[model samples]
Target: MSVTAITASTNSSSVRGSANATTNCLRLRRSHILFGTEKRYLSNQCVQNFRFTKPSNECGQRCIRVEAGWLFKGGGEQGSDARLERSESANEDILIFFYQLDLATRVQYALNLEEYDIAKQLRNKLNEVEAEVIKQREMKRGSSSKSEAQDKGISLLRLRADLQNAIENENYSLAAGIRDQISKLEADSLAATIKAQAFEKAEFEFRLGQKVRHKKFGYRAVVCGMDPVCCETSSWMENAHVDQLTRGADQPYYQVLVDVHEDPNLLVAYVPEENLLAPEEPDKAKFDHPYASFLFYGMDSAGDFIPVKQLREKYNRPRHEVPYDPQQDQTGDDNA
Candidate 1:
């Protein structure tokens, strides 16, 4: 073989090998493109299958994985559909947490309210019990007061009845004793009544004064003096005595001078103080004039008016007739 021919042959063989290698490289690139197109179509088909699965239990898990990958790659479907599903899950979790917290708070509030209501009920019951106790005590006091009043009234009535019986039977000693008892009762009752009245008047601001009516006396007398009279003999005589007088003998007499205001011609009459009233204003017209008049025609042996002292002596004297002497009559006839 020539050198030129061998070199041409080598060059031709190299060109042919290079041409084959280039063809294989083109074939591998075409295969790679086809495989990539197949993968893209499979991914699109998977998405379409997920849309067609109608949210069943089995398909839901697959949908979650596919959508998660798509979101990580930042590609596919604008993410609106998958976002809706994720939002629903998040909302469900939030609702569950809210329910738990709300239930716990409600339980605590209910317990507090129940305790408050129980406390209020107990307070009201205590108030009722206290009021009942006060009412019972008042009732007991009223009953006791009524019984005491009834007993006292019965005793007073019996005492009064006994006093009346003693007075009717002329038992002076018994009557006097009863009178003392009655006086004591009256004083005690008066004192109690006065004390009660004073207490009432203090609260009500009552006035104190004498009250009167004009029909009878037209004036009221206040009890200015309450002096009790002494029962001694000396006090009695000092209060009730007449004048002591001496007669012709050694006998002394007590004469009381009586007053005759309306009649000057009438003399003073004497009486004992026991038989007379303490000299109040008297009716003068009743005593001054006599109801009947007697005129005597006898000679004026005494004056027309007779002193009360001598009237008793003259009234006791008997009438006497003058006797005629016979010797005196004969001597007178001879002289004639």
Candidate 2:
């Protein structure tokens, strides 16, 4: 049947697997949301919209969704109109994340096979990826913050002008309303600046792209994003049992990509920092996730996924380099 829109909701099931690797099977409830007559389905990945010409098994599969000419959005009138319905940031981040993951995976595979030369080349490439991630992050921060501030300044100027016009016209009521709006806008701008500063000062125990395990649930996950403090609503915080934690919901929270092999339905998870810990040893095993292909460049010697440049920039995270271990190559060679 032709579909216009679809919504998914997740429900938890009995945990499965080893005690240290338990996972909840999440079931999605489908519902319809009507947009234009164009058929669309909710995507499991960054691709938010889809059009299907035929009934296919791939309907519910995870993928990075990109519309035709997505890059051209906001380039012209048609582009400007389409911008209202699409966000390019998530799709771009997924593409970059996949690249990093692929590179890291190849590096790990080469090392596992005792191909030191190939691993060396991949390692060099990993360094290059890290540099690019740092560059992109700096550029995003420089440009985004500047643009946001400029936009806010321009808006304030226009509102002030309107307030002046209202007063000149002896429209006291209109002037009062405009003055209130201006005050609120200025207050919001100040709050934004404060928030940005807080983010810069925020510290966390975990870094982006680190591999971690759930202390309570025993699920393996990789860090993709983080907040200085828990940012969920009160209701969500209660449901998540955040109140019971010794650190409470004031601690850092992370956006993690769950291993699909463990729980295919639990794609992206927002977890508290207190609930996560770095693995005791490097996990050499493959980490299976639908978004892994696009969200990470490669696995490091430490078994952590290298997040793509865009992904790093999205969270304002710095690039991380795996420490060099000369003995690692010798060990691989001995194994070979």
State the local distance difference test value for candidate 2. 0.57
lDDT of all predictions: 0.26, 0.57
Candidate 1 regions exceeding 4 Å error are 1-154, 204-336
List where candidate 2 sits over 4 angstroms from the true fold. Answer: 1-197
Model 1 lowest lDDT segment of ten: 1-10
lDDT of 1 by residue, 140-240 (tens): 22333344445556667888999999989999899899888877776665544443333233221100111111121111111100101111134333332
Q: Look at candidate 2 and tell me the lDDT of residue 223.
A: 83
Best by TM-score: 2
Model 2 C-alpha lDDT per residue in residues 1-336, reported as the tens digit of each score: 222121111111211112221112122221011111121222311112212122222433333222221111112353232122121232233434554555566567667767666566657755665566556554433333444556777899999999999999999999999999989888877755654554567788998789998775666888877766665556666666677888886667777876655544345667777879998889878887656766688898888999878677767678988888899989999999
What TM-score against the true fold does each predicted structure earn? 0.18, 0.47
